[model samples]
Target: ATSVRRGLRSTLRLGNRLAEEWWRQGIAWRAMRRGEVVVFDRHFFADYHAYDIAGTDLPLSRRLHGFLLAHAYPKPDLVIYLDAPPEVLLARKGEGTIEALARRRQDYLSLAAVTTSFEVVDATRTLDEVTSEVIALIRAFEQRHGAMATTS
Candidate 1:
């Protein structure tokens, strides 16, 4: 509850800052076009934003429509979906309660629909396997896309 509220507040509040928004989008797009193998820590908006309390329903199509109208369709080039059991996720819980963690996990699954470039990875694997798989996929993407450059 607290996390959801805070995340909403930050997003809505940040939305008011056009400069930040533009800067972020600019950097992200730049990196993308440069062919940099960038990994977004949390590209989970529909997860947090497109939801109602008590975990009822989300009008995801509405958001997709908005993105399309904004010419934001055909979204990211690739998205990696990391899926692990709740127990596995909970094993690494930092501070949030089980309930919050569950909410976040479900949110990711829900948002998975809006993305086309999604790769689902079973979190049941060992850390080494996960890293290796991610690296291989990213390398493949880079190979096909011709390496990415970073300005920073």
Candidate 2:
């Protein structure tokens, strides 16, 4: 009975997560339809991959669901990965085990490897430095895409 309850709970959680992803996709599409730039702080595919929820250990149904969601979801125009060493991350964030952070960093890098519009920025620098680098990247992308630069 406990096993059955756990299964039911996991199933429910999966359903809820799917609904959230779908809703987020809808919002992105709507914003793009209006010619608005949609920026996601954290994307669903990367989140799932980092958390290992999309890994091969799950039952076939869950794995298939994750695969479908990853493939069907619209790819972002740019994915910037702010990378810092796990020790630095722990020192700065004061959260997450070093081992887990390392794993997640690797996972993110793996995803970025296959992603076309991806950039890795060193996050160990000062805030101003990091911000400047990111702005430069965005400006370069805009120029490449023929979008007028925005000053703000």
Candidate 3:
């Protein structure tokens, strides 16, 4: 019965994630179809890998579901990971511990390494510097795709 309960929980979670992904993707698709550039604050797979589903403490069911959902989701054209030292992240967030933040940062780096279009911008820099770097990346992507800037 415990295994059955785990299965049910996993199934429900998978369904919910898929539904959310479908809705979010619809928004992105519509925007892109209108020749607009869409930037997502955080991709679902990256968040899952860092926070919820990557740890060994999680059940096998959840890990499996996460794997499925990750594969099902479409890969982004560009993934900009704003990276900073763990101490800086902890100070800024006032939430997670330094060690935990460090681990999560490493996870993000690993994810970036695997992705085709990934950039790690130094978030420890000034806001203008970071913004400029991100803008440059987007502009490069737009140029490569022959896309004219429709909106800022």
Candidate 4:
């Protein structure tokens, strides 16, 4: 238990350091500043709680680290979570077990539940269908917020 706690703390500290550096780079922020749609392949939220470190009492340090990392960069205006079944993910990736995939799916669902600006899309559908859904969502967002300026 002690070792698991230490490992979690170490991982979080490293993640926090890397996120701070990325925030300083301003790559995402610059694009958003110019009204460009920033598509993040994998955001901090996914990675922050990727591991399930077993412990009855989560340390305050861990919570603080998560809070700081989350606040390191401005939250995205919209987060589109593409979700697929565990079996589908396993068939495609040929890596993680169904249990692991299911756990991740639950984590993502829980995160989406708490987040104010988030949408979940079924990725088990055809690629074209998924793309169309995402495009439709983006269009709706644009209609609501007005079109973003194309040029910086």
Best by lDDT: 3
Candidate 2 residue-wise lDDT, 1-152, digit = tens: 99898888887877887889888878877776765666678888777764434477777557856776667755566788899999999998899999999998998888776566789999999999998998888778777875421210
Candidate 2 vs. truth: CA RMSD? 4.3
lDDT of 1 at 94: 60
Clashing pairs in 2: none
Model 1 segments beyond 4 Å from truth? Answer: 1-19, 44-49, 52-74, 140-152
**Residues 1-152, candidate 3, lDDT per residue (tens digit)?**
99898788888877787788778878888788798888989877677765444556666656765665556666677789999998998788799898988887889898875577888899999999999999999999888867733322
Rate residue 144 of model 2 by lDDT: 88
Q: Report the C-alpha displacement of residue 9, candidate 4, in angstroms.
A: 9.9
* Model 4, span 1-152: residue lDDT tens: 99998878788876776666477437766876777777777666555543322223556565655565566544455678899999999999999899999997887776665455678899999999999999888888778867543321
Query: Worst lDDT window (10 residues) for model 4?
Result: 47-56
lDDT for model 2 comes to 0.76
For candidate 1, the lDDT comes to 0.58
Q: How high is the lDDT of residue 62 in model 3?
A: 66
TM-score, per-candidate, Cα-based:
0.60, 0.82, 0.82, 0.73
lDDT at position 142, candidate 1? 67
- Candidate ordering by TM-score (highest first): 3, 2, 4, 1
Q: 8-32 in candidate 1: lDDT tens per residue?
A: 7766654554345356657787877
Error of 4 at 94 (Å): 0.5
The local distance difference test score of model 3 is 0.78
Q: What is the C-alpha lDDT of each candidate?
A: 0.58, 0.76, 0.78, 0.69
